[model samples]
Target: MNTVTPPKERAAAPETAPASRRSLLKRPRQLWAVTGPLVIFVVMLAIVAGLTPTFLGSNGLTFIAAAAAPILLLALGQALVLNIGSIDLSNAAIAVLGAILLAFLLAPLAAAAPLLVLLIVTLFGAVNGLLVAYAQVPSFALTLGTLGIFQAAALVLSGSTTVYVSANGEAISALYQSGILGIPMTFWIGVVLAIVLWAGLRFTRLGLAMTAIGNNESGAIFSAVRNRRVKVVVFALSGFTAGLASIAIIAQSGSASATGAGGDLLLPAITAAILGGTSISGGVANPINVIFGALTVALVPIATTAIGVDAQAQNLVYGLVIIVVVALTMARTRGAVVK
Candidate 1:
């Protein structure tokens, strides 16, 4: 046996142990992975609290919530899509079109405008899913192409202007205007949606399937995971969230402007998701954490003001911080697959 042994054969003889929940709980890296983002969130808030002193007061909190709501929803959608190892660049475009189309519908349909708008965006998501999952097109490329088309369509549809809602349009207009216990109604809606998103990703079989597919596509297919169907549904769900976010957007401004209104959110939402501890690679994500991620992102301008940093410097700082955190997290899971 000793005389016949070869180097290549010996190297292949050892099998790696499978990762287990018990081992995960024991690993400090697991602890850091779960706690790091939360720590960042608290630290950011603490800095803000110290700098402004009044920023945590009632009015300040309300202002932050109202501003962060749409971003939170967008981050929610982005997190979901990214969890499945995919990207969606069409969100901002969808939001723009959703708002414009809703405004156009409201003049005639009135109370039915919101429902109709949600349905339209949902269908658009399904189409996106089909193209990405069935056509074998890369999500990044497909979404980018769709992005240009939708943005152009929105502008052309609106004739390059902002859409406005009348005060008389109370039913639809109140979506952004009304509040409960002094909080924006949209904020409550966002909270509910966050819970739903979290539950879907963390508790459902479909969520697990998505995670499996993200973790190992070949293995998932071998294990009978409905990879295509799960991806389609993920895209559809992302679209549904985009629809909700679009409502919030229109509610805030009372119109969907054809001039790149929603487009700006895509990058920030993605940054928030990554910062929230959703892995850049496939296999790990937490939707609930993304809400706090939105909060941390929303705090950027505020943090800049608090620290006397220039607005222009904020993005650079945000990027550096997120990149470092992600790098460290990746290092922690370097040896074995994470899910």
Candidate 2:
């Protein structure tokens, strides 16, 4: 009797290939990745520069930098999460919670408060990771449920009042106040963070695993990637970033509302990520592009105010701009595969 033959499984791509570096830097699609945001940035800048002669001037530029700071960090966190094929709906809520905790803790803990808040935030993210990775819960449902719980907890814990730490606007605002080369420290800090994230995502084995799983989970499993551990770390990084953003929010407002006032930033954060060439679906992230995307988004409101344009008009324009950026980036990614 003839025995039935089993089909052989296809092999996964080699994990240690040097093609990763070349693929990142030499991909023709990478050019579009940079150009799309840079072009949008320059165009909007020109329009705003023409509309208000001062928009691109020294102080006007500083204003944009300051405004973009916290939102940019939130976008950073969101971009990282999206890269891993997940979402963190509680990112802004966590920032608000961290701010409130920082305000109260800074009085007693001093500089250590930021550290403590980051730890707590990381733990919160660990919980999300555990549920999502081990329990197989849908990230959207998990994050959405956690969002409500965390937001309500923040409101209740802080009595729905704005908390102002005495030290909030002091050394914490140093970056917002000072600039090097006429560029605000806020923008510089964002650039530094972008570089750090880019390096982590490009040069590290952890980053390789994250991308592998994001792009193709079955392949990653076939390659023996530690999928669950990577998820936890990525989510933890997102939470840590959210905590860092709380410091920026405190510096900007000199206070934080318990009702999670900055929670509204979630939309703009997601917008900036998408605008930065990050795929909402998964498997794409460019922190450098995120910086440019952030700068462009930050300038819009400032531009409207400078030119005396109504918020309604600005919203209309903002929607159009975001649509254009997303479309261009998506097309670029698709074109790269086609080629």
Clashing pairs counted in every model: 0, 0
For model 2 the local lDDT of residue 254 reads: 66
Query: What lDDT tens digits, residue by residue, belong to model 2 across residues 1-339?
Result: 011223431132354567555655776666676678878878888887898886666478778777788788888888888888898888888888888888878777777887898899889878888888999888889989999988987888788888887753566666556679766676677788889999999999998788778787778888999998888888888788788788787766667886645788888888888788887767788888888778878887787778888867988877786777677765233223321
State each model's C-alpha RMSD to the native. Answer: 6.4, 6.4
The best candidate in terms of lDDT? 2
- Candidate 1 residue pairs in clash (backbone atoms < 3 Å): none
lDDT of 2 at 74: 84
Name the runs in model 1 displaced over 4 angstroms.
Answer: 1-26, 180-182, 324-332, 335-339
TM-scores of the candidates in the order shown: 0.86, 0.87
User: What lDDT score is found at residue 147 in candidate 1?
Assistant: 89
